[model samples]
Target: MKIRILTRIALLAAASAASFAHAAPAMVTEGILTGGNGMTLYTFDRDAAGSGKSACNDACAKNWPPLKARDDDIAGGDYSIVMRDDGSKQWAYKGKPLYFWVKDQQPGDKTGDGVNNAWHVVKP
Candidate 1:
């Protein structure tokens, strides 16, 4: 009976670990802007003049939720973090803040792009 209990415990632990590992990080593509169950990726305007700061906040943020970073997320290239008013971490790339659209219903959906003539799709 002790052996069976131990086996069950081990299996449960393994399953938990697998679930955590399978969680996807915010990703960016030419189509999908933002999503749940994974990291939603977004792009910023090339002409946006900011030094690693996000201009979207409050009402603007409601439509375009910023892609948050986990504690273990490693910053690379121009990627960095911005502090939101609600004390959340927002991801920034090349000095532009990234955001996800609320209208995108599934993966590969780029419904947020060119919405108000300011947002664009993040390639790759």
Candidate 2:
């Protein structure tokens, strides 16, 4: 019975580990931004900071999800929150909206940068 319980505990631990393996990101490195899962973060050229809005919507947004801002998040310095067309709040750096590319699978992947001459990595 003890061995059975031990095996169950081991299996549960392994499952937890697998689940948390990709539960990272939402982190910023130096001046560069990262996604909730460690993928590269980017911004769209069409997005206008002066307008305080995100232009990437509909099909574009499906591939690039905005970095969400929590209700308790407070804007400080270069970081701020902007309202999207869908009424969702997103994190912004220097007024530019932040997004995650669907194709970026790894932590440092920059595959989405310069795509179609619009997407670019968010720099410091």
Candidate 3:
């Protein structure tokens, strides 16, 4: 019975690890790109794609914090990274800088969308 219990525990552990890997730092859900925390990700319409720049900075960044990228993250396909004015690496989708709205209280909150007609939800 002890051996059987150990086997089941091992299986559960493996499953949990797999889920973490699949989620990684970002994932698509319900046709929208979301942060690891499941909060809605958005883009600034004013930011020019491939400019390697973020228009939202200073006080603006406080309200719409960029989805920061880790040092080990590699840009590929539609997913890319941008260097913020502060020299931090930030994740971008299809060349649009990604951000998390501070007003969003939880996952699936899209209060930042269409704000001032500049911010929009990033769709997968």
Candidate 4:
């Protein structure tokens, strides 16, 4: 009976680790891209897609916080990583870097859309 219990515990631990590895930092929420916390994600028009870099930095990054990614985080599907001006990693989708508006106080808020005709929420 003890051996059976030990085997079951090992299986559960392996499954949990696998789930974390494949988990995406962002997901489609209400038909739009949102962080794991459900906050809306946006893209800047000034950021050239597929550049592997983010144009929003310094003061610009203050208002629109980049979707940060850790060194261990893996990118898959339409998700990718872009190096920031500070040499940090950020999450991107389809080559466009993702960000969050500071004014958004709660999840599902898209107050950052169309800001200065540049910022827009990522769809799908």
Clashes of each: 2, 0, 0, 0
What CA RMSD would you report for each candidate?
7.2, 9.9, 7.2, 4.5
Per-residue alpha-carbon lDDT of candidate 4 for residues 1-124, written as tens digits (9 for 90 to 100)? 9999999999999877865775797989889999988999999999999999999999999999999999988777899999999999999999999999999999989999999999999997
Kindly give the stretch of ten consecutive residues in candidate 4 with the minimal lDDT sum: 14-23
- Full-model lDDT, candidate 3: 0.88
What is the lDDT of every predicted structure here? Answer: 0.65, 0.80, 0.88, 0.94
Model 2 clash pairs are none
| Residue 41 in model 1: lDDT | 59
Best by TM-score: 4
In terms of TM-score, how similar is model 1 to the real structure?
Answer: 0.61
**Candidate 1 lDDT tens digits, 21-80:** 623444444444343544345665632545555667789778777887666555555566
Question: Whole-model lDDT for model 2 versus the true structure?
Answer: 0.80
Put down candidate 3 lDDT per residue, 11-100, tens digits, no spaces.
999877654543345688888889989999999999998888899999999999999987767677788889999989998888889999
Where does model 1 exceed 4 Å of error?
A: 1-25, 28-40, 44-50
Count steric clashes of candidate 3. Answer: 0
Candidate 2 lDDT by residue in tens digits, 19-116: 55542225676567876666778989888875688998889889998888766556666777898888888888788889999888778889999999
